[model samples]
Target: MEAEYLRHGVPLADYQLTKADHRRQREAVQVHEWVQRQLAEAPPWSDERWEEMRQLLGSPTPPWELQRWQLRLYCGHVIEATRNRNSPRPDGGVCDKKRCPDCGLDPAVIVAFEPLGPAAEPPAESHSLRSSRSTRQPPADRRSKAELVAENNALRAELEVLRDQA
Candidate 1:
């Protein structure tokens, strides 16, 4: 089944897939390294921000669900694989078969994906201050994309200022 193939790679022989088919399938599920890098560099998730997102989605428990929504906010599809954590790919990455639940979106345009940093680490005073500032805003779901982007830019700027002050 296509779903099974996407969630967990099938043996080429079993599926009668050529190498090219496998390659194409892999590419379909691939998330570029830059996307991962950008996410890695983004600020960690603040407790309030995390809670807010949880509430927005009505608290989906599975990691993939939230991750899928996050990717949608950035790129309009689930570019990254998050399902089946215990089973990784042969290369030690996430299994591509576990990615994007079928919105059938093309890979995200790199330029379209914006990083909204949230604090994952223990907040420095400045970071806490930043969180306090964000707490005043309307909920994320209600905000326009432009507004969110602008706010993110402003937060990044504020963080730079705080870093310089330290």
Candidate 2:
């Protein structure tokens, strides 16, 4: 029975590995073809294209544009204050003073307060597949094990035919 699974003087395991390699090569070729199609369809790079790319790469809001107050604690530690947060005064009178993130023992003096800007937009794309997988709601496959095995066998036969043609 095991001898029947041999292909062209090759062991069943070796044959299976070759078939798997072919499948991987076919997938890589498909990805290259898709990229070629995209390049062919895409417009040539122009100033507008550069600007679009820049916007895509750029942060939605500049970091320096945020309402930030540089607070200098009497303990010589510098900390930043954001919007709606209590800022230390120069005279150490308004809000909570002597509240340092590092020391938390001395009066904090407001060094500089900048003009506030717009809120930052949420990121367009996730950094990684693993992180995005949690947000992706793919449909559940409820196929039976037998049905899946039958489909796999059919695909394998089809692949064999394709391989022979190639």
Candidate 3:
């Protein structure tokens, strides 16, 4: 994953530990600078602002499409004021300041770190049976919009019948 970060926008096939660390640190700094630039052009951040930034970055990969939870790791800032000194952030950095520059939030938070590429895919199909048994929902897209509405109405009627029976 560190290697992925190092090779993001450059032609480095392999880098020494110091070089890799430098690349990651450089990218992190760039992210911060980008945010500052956005804030300069537009004071506060928003979904639209992030979309603009994402478009400018031109990829959904790290240091770009990263969610707020993940952003806290990279930015050392958050929307809400927090002072947890032990909070683990990206690159093993921590910020206990009342006003952190890197903190922000989004509607969705990704709980795990994932590097770009095919390795991000799910585990092998050997556990397909277990996964299948747990998830019984039909694919949502299989039904048309009208079909879904009709099914919802039928389910409501069935629910009312069950209530009356009770």
Candidate 4:
């Protein structure tokens, strides 16, 4: 049956298709119908032309559902193939800048670049001390302690001088 043929011909399982796939399939069928109508309306064409049209309709190809599936497969393959190829080196954490290691793809083929920096390293104890010191504030009660101390010492010295005079 036609349904059986369509089911069998799909590269992926029927359940795997997303809603987008269904929409694409519907659009493809519409386009196919339009093409068929256009071909029918045109004046008698040569055998070669007819054959070409037939080929367009018959192959594992087109009518939208197949094209969408093919595109999905192609995209997935490219992503997986390039992922490892473009991965950064183990020692430096930097990916090879010149070429892909796995596929030998040119630098231009990679859409994004990721820089690998040094691996995790703990901060020194001194670093935490510096941070804490920078954030500390003086107690509210001792806010003017330095100035008060200086004033008290001056007053005491003056008293001692006055008492000496007495």
Counting clashing residue pairs in each candidate, in order, gives 5, 1, 4, 1
List ranges where model 2 is wrong by over 4 Å.
1-66, 85-93, 96-98, 106-166
Give the range of the ten consecutive residues with the poorest summed lDDT in model 1. Answer: 1-10
Candidate 3, 13-115: lDDT as tens digits: 2212345444655655566668788879976678998889988988544322232222222232222221112223322243211223444322112112212
TM-score of each: 0.28, 0.22, 0.21, 0.23
Among the numbered candidates, top TM-score falls to: 1
| lDDT score of residue 81 within candidate 1 | 31
Q: Rank the candidates by TM-score, best first.
A: 1, 4, 2, 3
Q: After superposition, how far is residue 109 of candidate 4 from its true place, in Å?
A: 28
Predicted candidate 2 versus true structure: per-residue lDDT over 70-114, tens digit per residue: 444334455555433122222224433435688754234322233
Model 1: per-residue Cα lDDT over 1-166, one tens digit each = 0121112222222333346545655464465555677899999999999989988989434442121112221123323333322222221243223233555434422111112222133337755776788778777569788989999999999999999999
RMSD of 1: 20.5
> Model 2 clash pairs?
98-106
In model 4, what is the error at residue 43, expressed in angstroms? 0.6
* Candidate 4: residue pairs that collide: 88-95
Candidate 1 residue spans exceeding 4 A from truth: 1-13, 25-32, 59-96, 99-166
- The C-alpha stretches of model 4 lying farther than 4 A from their native spots are 1-11, 47-166
